[model samples]
Target: MVLPVGRSFYVTTDYGRVKGFRYAADNGRPDAPVVVVQGGISGTGQLWRLDGSGWWQSLYDAFAETEDLQVISFDYLGGLGGSTTPEQPLTVEQHALAYLQALEKLGVDRIHGWVGGSFGGVLGLQAASLKQGPPIDRLTVIGAAHKPSIQSSLLRSFQQLLLQNCDCEQQGVVLARALAMLSYRNADEFERRFEHPDDALEYLLAQGERLLQRHGKQANKLFTHLTPILNDYHIDVRQITCPVQLVSFSSDTIAPPALVSELEALLPDCDSYVSIETPFGHDGFIKNVADYQTSLSQYLPQLAETHV
Candidate 1:
């Protein structure tokens, strides 16, 4: 049996140490390093869990099992089960700081590529621009944008408002889940998928549970802090020195195609950006994995190529 790579934990510039697992073939070769940035507002170490049917592992499975690559990722401080919590207001910059710390502590000098979607994509662009930390050879940002729309910000604020108004601490789970499902989904996708649903009650209940799962219970206050912050979260997409490949979809109303184009123009070293022909909506990363994989196959190798 092929042995899976060993997993481990590391400390950060915060309250508690983070837990993470890596996957790489044990042949003495230096693994073609890469990182997978998760977009969930809550914790998603499960995405990398090889034990169960994890989403990330499933995505990586598309590549060669023996493909040597270091997969390093972690839960954000404010994320569901991340080891630490920020005492102060959480900002996009602060979250990026935590992610950069993880890459550094892991001894990853540079990543061959970075796969980011939504929030993670925004952070990736910021990381590449500073041209600091690890040398990011390639950038793949999907369902992302250079700025947050006023509606997006207000939507997040409403979530915090709901959480703050509630008297119970358990309400955090509800707020987190609700926001997660709503944000996780591309609004346009919903209209398309639910038009002919048979069990309206079950679907509505699912949405409810996705949000109010732990109502009346204590929740991480970071959710409250982050809600309003999303409104102010915007990144200047130009400073990156490596090639960038953006994936835009027709149905992604949140990060519209136009915004993607505008952001693409800001990249200093971008190789190219493509808009996919899919009705998969904004959350296409999870919905349309094959389309992204096909694109990555072309993008990653080029970034890894030695020009000299």
Candidate 2:
């Protein structure tokens, strides 16, 4: 197995300790501009640890080679190897505080940019809006909104119900995750990938099995506790003063274009809104990273001058 190559440490926070990893840029500057890349709910801080076979390997390599750029990322406070399981439900503000405290511990007073999608994106927004956290210079949000839409909220509620009704928590998590996959992807992807009904059924079952193996029996409890926070995510956008770029996929159902548009109008300093066409739905942020990067490059000249 290819393991993550970096130093790992923990930082104390209001919620608990957060696990983080630091990747120094090869440009040989210790005081380099720092960029934070965060992933969705099912991910960890080790997301950028790319092997050659993974889709993200090229994207990781691209940033790793950027001059005077350092990347720092941490796992969510309640997930995997990060902090202990939440004793109570964690709000978006609490999640933001944990991330702020982690960076404070690392002596990061100002962030060059913060990139996140879905759950991570909303958390970034919440963090930037807070008066107590480190200042963010630039922000990139992909397929996320200030709060869950009515359709998305209803779907999550159903997933939660399914999780609570199962006899085995592991099985429940598997089912819930499978259902979430449907939301992450569009109908066109399913039609193209599966020729027959049996293939589709098999694929979903496999994905569920993988989740069960990765999360064990605690999967249901963890998601059950976290779902409400995701649904209730809200922040005062007027508080955000940094330039922001919002990217939404045309096919994304969870964080659709209309919701992203509403978020863009609310931001006091929104730089641009780029809508990309993709069949991957809400997961297009990862599925079409090359296109996403192309959109981001438009702001590169601006970022460079700001850092200089």
**Each model's RMSD to truth, in Å?**
4.0, 3.1
In candidate 1, which residue ranges exceed 4 Å CA deviation? 1-6, 14-16, 26-32, 55-58, 167-176, 183-192, 195-222, 277-279, 302-308
Winning candidate number (lDDT): 2
Mark the 10 consecutive residues where model 1 has the least summed lDDT. 213-222
True-vs-predicted CA distance for residue 140, candidate 1, Å: 0.8
Q: Which lDDT tens digits does candidate 1 get at residues 145-179?
A: 77875556666767677666878645544554455
Q: What digit string (tens of lDDT, one per residue) describes model 2 on residues 1-308? A: 11234457788877887888766644346566777777777766775554544323434633643655667778776665455667887788988888888898788988888888787789878888997767988888988988888888887888889877999877787888888888889899999999997898788878888877876765554575566678887789889999999999999988999999999999999998889999999889788777777666556543344333
TM-score per candidate: 0.81, 0.91
Judged by whole-model lDDT over C-alpha atoms, candidate 1 comes out at 0.62
